[model samples]
Target: MNKVFLLSLYEEAVRVSKPKHCLPQYFNAFSKNDRVCVLGVGKAAADMAVEAHNYFGSNAYGLVVTRYGYENTESTGNIEVRLAAHPVPDENSVTGANALLAAASSVEPSESVIFLISGGGSSLACAPPSTVSLEQKLSLHKFLLRSGASIEEMNTVRKHVSVIKGGRLAAASKGQNTSLVISDVVGDDPAFIASGLTVQDTTTPQDAIAILDKYGFDNASPLRGYLANAPLLPKVKGDYKLVANAQSAIDAAVEMAKASGFSTRVISYTEKGEAQEVAKRHAQIALECKQQGKPILLFSGGELTVTLGDSKGEGGPNQEYLLALTKYLDGEPGICALAADTDGVDGSKDVAGGFIDESTLRNAKRKKIDVNAMLAEHNSFGFFESLESHIKVGPTRTNVNDFRVIYVS
Candidate 1:
C-alpha cells in the first residue's frame, strides 16, 4: 500500500470508470433514421454525442452543452458542440440551452430525440427562466454549493430557476425523448442527474421550497414562491434508461484488485454525504480489516456534497474526503486510498483528486503541514499542494460523479 502501488490501482480503476467507453455500448440499439435528433447536456454529453455519431454516423443531428474543456477535442462533423459554465449558470449556458429547446421545439412529432443526459448538465446546460438572469442563477448556485446542501437540493433549486429542467426537455420534444442517463446523485434518482432534463420528477414545489429553506435561501431566492405547490411534473414525461453507473466503476476496480493479487470487495457505488465524515468512516473500516481479511477495497460511485463553511479553501469533495480520512488514520499501516470525481474536476479547482497512503500525513507532518487546520478550512487543495500530492488529470470529459477506492495489502 505504497503511493506508487496505490496510484497504479487507482488509475486502473479510473481508466475503467470512464463515461466515454461506456456511452457507445448503449447506443447500439439506436436506429440511424432520416429524422433523428441526438441532444446532450451534461459533463459527459460531448463524448456521448461523439459516440452517438460514431454509431449512427451522419444520421444523428443535434447539440450537446458541456463545461469548457470537457468537449471532444477532435471535431465531430455531425454533432454540434457547445461549451458553457459549470456548477453555475452563465450567459453561454443560456444560449446553449436555448439551442437545445429550439431544436426540440422545431423537430417534427415523427422524429425521435435521443437525449444524452449525464452529470453536470443541470448547471452547464441551463437556461434560467426569462425572469431569472444568469447572474442570479450563478450567485445562487455558488451559494447553494457552500451551504451543505445535497446535489438533489442544489438541482431542486436549479429546476425551478430554469425553463428546461426537470423533464422540460422531454416536454419540449413533443415526440419521443429517449434519455440515456448516467446516474450521479445518491440513489440514482433520475430527477437529480443534471436536473432531470429528460426525466420526470415526483418532487413537488414543496420539495423545492424545502431545499431552499434548508439552505437558508428561502427569502433570497426569487423563484421560491414558484416552488410552493408547483406542478408535480415537468409538463411532459419521457422514457429513461440507466446506461452506466457507479457500480460499473466499483466492479471494475474490484476485479482489477483481485487480478493484481489482492482479494477485494466493492462496498457500494451509492455512498453519499459530507466528504470529511466519509473519509473517517472509510479509514475506520480499512483499519478494522487486517491484510488477511480479503484486503478490503471499498469503491463508491455517487457524488458527495461539501458544505463549505465560510468560503472554504480550494478543493473538491473528493479532496476533502481524502484529507479527512487521513485525520482518522493517524499514520496507520497498510492503508491507502484514492478519491476523485469521475468527471475529472473537483470543486472549483482544476485538480481531479489526490492519493494518500499511511505515510501521506506522516510525510506532511515532517514538513510542518497542519493537516487538521487545512482540513478545517476545507482546503484540501492547499494541503495537497504543500505535499505535492495533488492529482491533476484535466477534464476526463465524462461524468459519473465521484469515484473512490481504498486498498489494504
Candidate 2:
C-alpha cells in the first residue's frame, strides 16, 4: 500500500504538467484566424506541438525537435518532428538547430510564432558558433555533467557557446513571438529554461567564462578565446509564459497527499546540490517526522546533480539519492521514500528512479550486497536492480525536474 501511494503521487505530479492538461488553456489568447507557426524544442516538444496542431488544425504548421525516443505518435499532420541527442549534443542536434533557425527566420511579419520550450532543449537543439567545433562543445558538456555544477551554471556556459540559444531563435523571427515554457529548472525562470530560446538573455559571456573557471575546466581551449570576443546577444520581443514547473508538480502532489489523510510538509520546491549530500539532509528531516508518531508526507522538487569524478556511475541522480538515503535511514520503521524525475528518464538511464523502505537495508544484507561499495562506485542502479526496487516509467512527455516523496508514520 505504501508503494502504491508513493507511485500515485508521482503520477499525479507528472499528469498535471503534461502538455495536454496544462497547455491548451494558454492557447485561448491566440485567435483561431491568426496564422500560427509553432517551433517546439525539448523533452516535451512533440507533445506541445501536437497540442498546438490540435488547437489550430489546418492553420498551425511548424517543426519540433525532441530527445531521441521521445516522439509522440499522435497525429500532427503538418508539424514535423525531429529527434536529436540530449545531455550531449550530436550531429542530429546541429541539424535540428539549423532547421529550427530556418523555420523561425521564415515566419512572415503577419504570422504569429509560438515556441514550445522545455527541459533538454539545451542539447536537443544545439547550434554552436563556428569558432567552437562540435567536438569541443561535446567535451565541454561531458565535463560539466561530472563537474557538480548547478543547472544554471552549466546553461550559463551553454548560452555563450551556442548560436541558436540565448534568444537567437526569437531574434531570427520576423513575426510576433510567444514562448510557452514547461520549466525544468528551479524558480521557473524562462531565461534558463531550454537556455532561453525565445527569451532575451541577461547573462554575459564573461559569466560563462567564470562558471567554467570555477569548475576547473581547461583554460587553453579555443572556446575561451571565442568567449572573450563573443558578440552581445540580441534583445528579443516576445511573450513568455511558464505553463508548468517544479512548483506545479509539487502542488499537485501536496493535494494528493492531503486527500490521502497524510500530514504533509513541502520542504522545498527548489532543491539542489550533490545527490548523496542532499539525501543525508533529507534523512534527518524524515527522522524528525518519524518522532512525531503520526502519518506524514514530505515532498520536494528541483533537479539534483551527481559529480561522477573517477567512478563511472551506472545510475542517475534519483537512484543515487535513494541509495544514499537508505543508508542514512538505517532501516527505520514506518518510513519509505521515492525519488524520480518527472520526465521519466533519470540521468542517462532509461529507469525513472528508485523506491526504498524500512526493509531495504535488511533485504540488501540478506542478499549479501555491498551497499557502501556500490555507492562509492556510483552504481546505485545496480544496487536497486539487485533488489528489484528501481522504477521504470518511460518518457512521461513532460519535465518539471525531479519529484521526491518521503512517508513517515
Candidate 3:
C-alpha cells in the first residue's frame, strides 16, 4: 500500500459515481413530451441537467443553480445556468431560488417539474422566508457549520427558516413534481438532501429549535422565533428517485479494490461523528487487518464533522480525518489510507482531501513539520501542502458526500 495504489482506488471510486454514469439510467422512463422543467441544484446540478437535456432534448426546460465556478461551460440549451454561493447563502442564492419558484409557478398543471437535487443546494438556492432576512440566514449558516452539526441537523434548521425549502418549492408549484436527486446525506433521505426541496419534510419547527439548542445556539438567536412560527408544508404527490448516493460510490470502490486482487469489505457507508475519533477507529481497524496477514481493503463513505474549536487553520473534515489517522498509524508499515469529499471540494478549501501512508509521520518528521501541532490548529491543509500530500481534483461536478478507503498489504 502506497500513495499510488491509494490514489488509484480513489479515482475508481469517483469514476463510477460520476453524474454522467449515474444519472442517465434513472431518466429512461421519463417522456420527452411530459413538459418537464428540470430544476438542477448543487455541485452536480449542471452535469445532471446536461444529461437530462440529452434524454429529453428540447422537451426539457428549466434552470440549474450550482456553486460559484461550478457551472458547465458546454452547451446547456433551454436550461438556464446560474452561479450562487455554497455552504453559505448570498444574494445570488436568493435570486436563484426566486427563479426556481417562478419557473415552477408558471408551468401548467399538465406539465411536470423535475428537480435535480444534490448536496450544496441548501445554500446554493437560498430563499429565506420574509420574516428571516438574508443576513440572518447567512449568520445561522456560519454558526451551524462551525458547530459541527451533521448535514441532517443543519438542513433541519435550514428547512424551518426558508421559503423554498422543506417541500415549499414543490408545494408552490402548480405542476406535478419529480426530483432526480444526488444524495449526499446519511440514509439518502431526500428530505435532508438540499433541505428536501421537493420531498415532504417530517421535521417540525420544534425539531429545528431542539437542534439549534443542542448545538448551543443562544435563545436570543433569531432562529428560535422564526422556527417556532414557521409553517410546515404538506407532502405532495411527486416522483422522487435516488439517482446516486454514498453507498454507490463505496460499492464502486470495493469492487475496484477486489478486482485489483485485494480482499475488500465496505464497513459502513453512513459512518459519521467527530473526524478525529472516526480516524482513530479506522486506525484500529487497519491494525486488526494487518494482523490477519492478508492483503485487505476497507472502505467507508459518509460525511464527517470537524468542530473547529478556535484553532482555525485551513482544512476540511477529510483532511482532519487523514491527519488524525496518520498519527494513530504511528509509522506502521503496510497500511495506507485516503479520504476525500466526492464533490471534489473539502470544507471551504479548493483541495479535495488528503492522502496518508504509514510513512506520512516519518516524512513529516524528515521535513521538520510538526504533525501534532498542525492537527491541533486544524491546519491539515497547511501540513499536507508542505509535504505535497494534498489531493486536488477540482470540482467533479457530482457529489455524494465523502469517500474513504484504507489499504493493507
Candidate 4:
C-alpha cells in the first residue's frame, strides 16, 4: 500500500477507538435516571463526558480534566470542564483533583459516580497527599519520566503520593461507583490506567518505595518516608470496565489492511521496552517480510519509553521509534513503516509521530540534517520536521497507546 493509504488506516484505528463512538455503549448500561457524578480524566475525558451528558441529560454533571487545548467547551453539557498539565502535574492539576474529590464526596448515596479514565490521567488527575507538596510532586514526576520507568513503575509511585489515586476516590463516595476506562497500559489493567481512581489498589506504599529505589532516584528519602507512613486506601466497592485499548486499535488497523488485500499478521499487542531497542527488533521483522517477496502488513501496539536523562530533545517515543527503525533498515527497499501515539500527541510534541520509508534518510541528508546527531540528542522531531515526514493529527481525543504498522512489498 502507498503512504496515503497506510496513514488513512492509522487514522481509522484512532477514529474507531474514539470516546464519542465507544463510550455510548457503556453509558447505555447505566440507568437514565441515575445521577452521574462524572470524573473524566485523560485526553479523551471531556469528550467522554459529553457522550455521557448526551445520554443522561441533566443527571450528568461533574468535573473533567483533560490535557490543555483538549477541553471541548462547546459540547461539554452540564459537565464542568478543566485543563491541567499532562505528563507532569501542575497547580491546576491539584485544583482539578480537589474539585473531582469534592464532587464525588458531595454526591448522595443514590447517585452513581462514573469515572471516565484513560492514559495521561495519572498526571491529569493529581491530588498529592498533605505530606507531599505540589512542587515536590512536580519534581518527582520529572525525575521518574527521565528515570526510564515503565508506566506500571511510575504509577506505583503515583498511587502512593496522590490522595485521589489508588482507589481513594471511590472510597470517598458512598454511591454506586463505576469506572469506564480507555486502557493505554500494556495489559489493559484498570488499576494502572489513571492509577485506578475507582478500582481497588492492592499495591502498598512499600511497593512505591521499592520502585523508587530500583531506579536509584536522587534524594528520595523524603518521598520514601512519606510512602512508608502513608495510610492505606479504605475498602471501596466499584466496577471497572475496559472500553477501548491498544489491542482493539491494532485489530482495527489489521482488519483495514486485510480488506485492502494485503496479507496481514498481528505481530504483538503488548510489546514494550526502550524505543530504540524495540525499533531494531521490529526492523528485523520487516527485513524478514521483505525477504519472503510478498506484500504483507505487520501490526503491533504498545507504549515504548524514551529515557531522556539530560538529553533535551523535542520528540516523543513514537518519533524516536521510527527514527531508530530507519537507521536499522539503512534504506532497505520495499519497507515502509509508521508509528504514532493514538492520542495524537507523542511525548511532549504536538505531532502524532513520524513516518519513514526507504528514502527517509536520503531525503534528510538532502536537507543537511544529520540523522545520527539528531538521534544521539533524541531530536527525532527536528529530523522529521526537516523532511516534512511527521504526522500531525492534532488531538483525536482518545488514547490507546502507540499504534505501529510495517509494510513489506
The per-residue C-alpha lDDT of model 3 at residue 277 equals 92
What lDDT does model 4 reach? 0.87
Q: Pick the candidate with the highest lDDT.
A: 2
Candidate 2 residue lDDT tens string, 1-409: 4888899999999999999999999999999777799998999999998899889987899999998889987977688999999889999999999999999999999899999999999999999898788999999999998898988998888988999989999999999999999999998878889998889889999999999898899889988899999987889998988899999888998998888776899999999999899999999999987786767888999889888888987889999999999999999998999999998988878999999999999999999987899889999989998999988999888999999999987
Return the TM-score for each candidate structure.
0.94, 0.98, 0.97, 0.97
Instruction: Give the candidate number with the greatest TM-score.
Output: 2
For model 2, the local distance difference test gives 0.91
Q: Candidate 2: which stretches are off by over 4 Å?
A: none
For each candidate, the alpha-carbon lDDT, in order, equals 0.78, 0.91, 0.86, 0.87
Which order, best to worst by lDDT?
A: 2, 4, 3, 1
RMSD of each: 2.1, 1.0, 1.4, 1.4
Question: Could you tell me which residue pairs clash in candidate 3?
Answer: none
Question: For model 3, how does the per-residue alpha-carbon lDDT over 343-378 read when each residue is reduced to its tens digit?
Answer: 889988899998888778999999898878988888
- Write one digit per residue (lDDT tens) for candidate 1, span 1-409: 6656655655665565455667777766666655578888887788777778777878788889988888686555578999998777678888999899999988788877889888888877778766666777777787788898888888877787778888887788877778888767778788888988887777666777777777677495666655563455656656678877777666766777778777665666777788887777787778778544556666666777777768548888999998988889888777788887777788888888888888888898899988889887888888888888877888876666777888776
User: Candidate 1 deviates by what RMSD?
Assistant: 2.1
Off by over 4 Å in 1: 17-20, 218-221, 226-232, 291-294
